[model samples]
Target: MTVASPLRFPDTASAPTMTKRGWWLVVMNILLPGSAQVLAGNRKLGRVGIVATLVLWLLAILTLLTYLIWPSTVYTLFTQTFSLLVVQILLVAYAALWVVLTLDTLRLVRLVKAAPNARAWIAAFSVVVLIGLTCTAGYASVVAGSARGALGDIFSSGPSQPPVDGHYNIMLLGGDAGPDREGLRPDSMSVVSIDAETGQAVTIGLPRDLNPVPFPTDSPLHSLYPDGYGYEDRCDVDVCQLNSIYTEVSLYKPELYPQAEKQHSDPGIESMRDALEGATGLKIQYYVLIDMQGFADLIDSLGGVDVTVSEKLPIGGDENLNGVIDWIEPGKQHLNGYYAQWYARSRHGTSDYDRMARQRQLQDAILKQVNPVNVVSKFQGIADAGTQVVKTDIPQSMLGYFVDLGMKTRKLPVKQLELVPPTIDPANPDYSQIHQLVQEALAPATPTPTSSK
Candidate 1:
């Protein structure tokens, strides 16, 4: 008679036990999104997760290696443009992934408990393998990322430089015409200085037309759409328009655009700095850019800024271009981002000098609006949003330290000046006189007009 073999029977007493592999697989799947599927014998699902993980890791590696190498990637990820939105999406994805992994872990545990014998052993083996792989992946990532960097690495991992003590002056150059705008101007030039001991931050703005022609520099003429070509370099820099820097870098010199930004300059900041320092006799230490878009966003992010009209501001436009001639009388008023941008860029407000005054006032507005409370609260949001926009010589790692310093000893009142006709005769700018004035100005006394008549 065909009888069921005693040993082949489904005996509850002989319930199978889990092995290291099974647990390993469960842990692996739990760590990422779908790693466990591979251990569970789901070839297709395992492949997808494996591929995705590899890609994510690759990007993470690239992010690290060049952390201090360039600001383009970080800038694109952290600014007010469309990239900010993408950062937000990634953030959400990260959160969702976390939740999914937690749920998955619980499910895996349940499955492992119910399984017996070979299945349990398989699961355990998977878990162990996964753990090993995970550790290996993590070590590889850290080593690669450390070698490369993510963001903080940029600042934290740079060669040490000498201190700026003797009449140290720097410039902030804001360009308008990117690679797209051919004959754009550099209307935003702020001469900045600080005393290491006194801890002061000083700035003065200039009109784009004030110089009419900046000392020549490379042109930005193309867009290197790296988003399209993974390992491809197609961007070029044509110094046709300052605003067009992005297009030029994106198009012609995409390779050099990012590398040059960090190592040196093609649309040279050094050249710009030399010209500025040469004109004003101030030693240029650092240079940074607050692009047009970022300028507007930063202002808006602070919910606009507060400024008192120092004089009657005639807000009107040409016969056709349009003007706001409401004549804002001198008083305290809250300005929106767009309005602030216009005010900072406006030359028709009386004279070009008045626009400089507006720029300093706006800078004050920014300092006032941002406080420890605001900064801490908005840190993550800012990190996510600004990862794509702001480009500076400064790196990410050092920001927190400086931010802490700022919180401790903040700039209560920004030391500011608008280089005027009497002190700054643009027709024939007197560099030596301006330099001496700046040196003296940093010593506590208010700066007097040093313009060459």
Candidate 2:
């Protein structure tokens, strides 16, 4: 035994770094993945680690930014087509970073074990821990739960009343999402108007491809342009697409200008107003475009909403348009996001006018679900879950007023009018002429004042 002990030796090479500076560097790396090295004067190595962290961080930021600014077409892929998987992958990355930071902290404690100058490293780690705690507390206290709350009630202001007679008109459009499509086009265009004096709501939807809006006056657009009238603008009447009429409003009505110029068929609001007013005989006040994505998110927030099916929805498609088969069972049912979206966008059945009818029904459903009693109980939950999903002409401040208006609709009846080739029953349909009949259906009826005589 004595002879064997003579050959035994200490394996110092395998032990912790007991030197003062070595331990300090270890602590720095533990606290910040290399901050201790910089503190101990290893400038190059510390800088490299920091640069690596910055690059990874910047990459993460870029990923989030792309998700936001992407074209509506691409955004649909992320939200619907590839939604859950993309979210899972991002979450994994965040988790991995958290795990690495945790391991690094334990490694640093082990590396500087029993070192005399370990005190300095320990103090440094303590300071770093304090900073982290401070940041977490700040976010929890002020940033996370309290932003936008200071603005007062969330739905305090909204479409207080559905448009009544003598009010503005709003148009809403929804797009069907698919691998073949990227951007949003107004799928459900509704002209929601409210009377300035006696708030009333009136809504109507126009098919995306409905065009060739005819005008009473027949002249080239070039001649009508007061700003730059010339022969350049030449279209006999508004023989252009109905959607394009929004673009050509200035040409026809040189007196007015449209707001909110957007890239793809922004369809100037004024022309939309003109088209509706010309067709309906009611002066349009305003137009609102509610995208499909926003509609989906809002529906989802309600944790599924209740809607009544007025007719059997027949969903089928052909080469000319986006389509769907009948989805709902044709009675009152609770619908989730996917189902709600389909209910709103289903175009397969009989006519586009029918699809428009579904849109109004869904709107009614939403207003009913968020009534005062429901809003208080379900509003916050839905809002927290789906705030990112909605964009609307009604500002956040105005939402509460709508809540008030929605309560009124509980007693008020909803009216739907279909305007198209079949305004005349198909059996008696006259191909030769029914324009006046169709026009008469869409025109707002003159309200007669009661005479007590």
Candidate 3:
């Protein structure tokens, strides 16, 4: 009875407890995030950490599944500014939380006195290293994942397209469609031949009005129109414009392209690539088709491209294409999306030859203006427009290689060649001469050797 009255607390201050936890707790934090916190008696923080990690993991899995099952939806999401912002915000928050949890784990370790001397220092170092590694790895993973989704969306899985003559020849098509017209038309076309080893490139522009188009032997059009794509036997009107290949083959003559039918993809681009190869004398490996109407958005995303306009250029057109909407003045001017598109497309008073030359000049301007910082800043906008405006046959597997190659190419001056007017008449193109021009354009740039003797 007397002992009970003493209100004895059994030596609570001197209670035997673990002075240190081994490096295992740091490892646990690395692997399972909040596990170390939970073990150190911070159940609330631990639970929150675990829950966040699980949610992120679930989201990653769901994103991968959606990309595989419904790629179009993924593409839409990737392109949307709001969606990209949300994703970027989530990633940043997640990274911050991960770093906070790691620091908290380190704090708990210190409070528990679980690591001593060198062990404590080692644990601290581990937390710092983990924080750095996690942040870097996390961001990289997000970028890579987004790129994968984008590549898949733009370039559908297709047959193996190997490089031809130590280079990948991609046809760049500027498609223009009008409500008044029966079908889509490629108003501008170019073949970008890139040297695989040196990343040297030549952009060879093919005049859209090129008539009496030739077709490759393996192409279905060749079998049907053995001599040329000219409508000599088929129609009274001259229905042999290179641009017509899209509408004629893609819409009217789908049954003719059995290979494209087998793949269940656009036969128009395939046929056009074949025609371009026959015209340029280069084996076209793939094609990237972009809607010309969407060119403004892309230009805006790039901030603006600078070009030296020698004279006034018109903008906009009417239902009957009767008058000009606006005019871009002369000299070196920074042109936005609207003006840049018009600069490339304006042909009311100007000849097709002038328009083609302007298009190539605009291309050169874009290549020069694009830089890494701006690219990152405008990535979301570009990505959004890219999905909607662009389509290609460049496979996902080769995206990294091409991205790297593009960077290298951008650093170097891009050689430009245009088959317009006096160079080679589009209305009556000399097939052999066009082929010869392509060969000469693609000829490797002579190396400026060292002078050390």
TM-score per candidate: 0.52, 0.46, 0.70
lDDT of 3 by residue, 1-453 (tens): 443121111122321322224355567777787777666647788888888888988988998998677544665565444465577667777777788888786665443433234455646677687768776757644664565456566765555566788898888888887676767788889999999877898999887778778888988788777777774534123366887788787777777766664452477878788789788888877778878889889999889899999888767776455676778999999999899888888877788778888888987788877886887666667767777789877655455467666767888888988888788877678989888888888888689999998
Off by over 4 Å in 3: 1-148, 231-238, 261-265, 317-323, 447-453
Q: Kindly give the number of clashing pairs for every candidate.
A: 81, 42, 3
lDDT, candidate 3, residue 146?
62
* Top candidate, metric lDDT: 3
lDDT of 1 by residue, 8-52 (tens): 122333334333333554556655555665444444655666676
Ranking by lDDT: 3, 1, 2
Error of 1 at 146 (Å): 19
Query: For all the candidates, what are their Cα RMSDs to the real structure?
Result: 15.0, 15.9, 10.3
Which lDDT value does model 1 have at 334? 80
Give the number of the best model, judged by TM-score: 3
List the candidates ranked by TM-score, beginning with the highest: 3, 1, 2
> What residue runs in model 2 are displaced by over 4 Å at the alpha carbon?
1-168, 175-183, 195-200, 205-209, 214-240, 244-271, 309-327, 384-403, 424-453
**Candidate 1 RMSD computed on C-alpha atoms after optimal superposition onto the true structure:** 15.0
lDDT of 2 by residue, 335-369 (tens): 88777877776655446667677777888777656
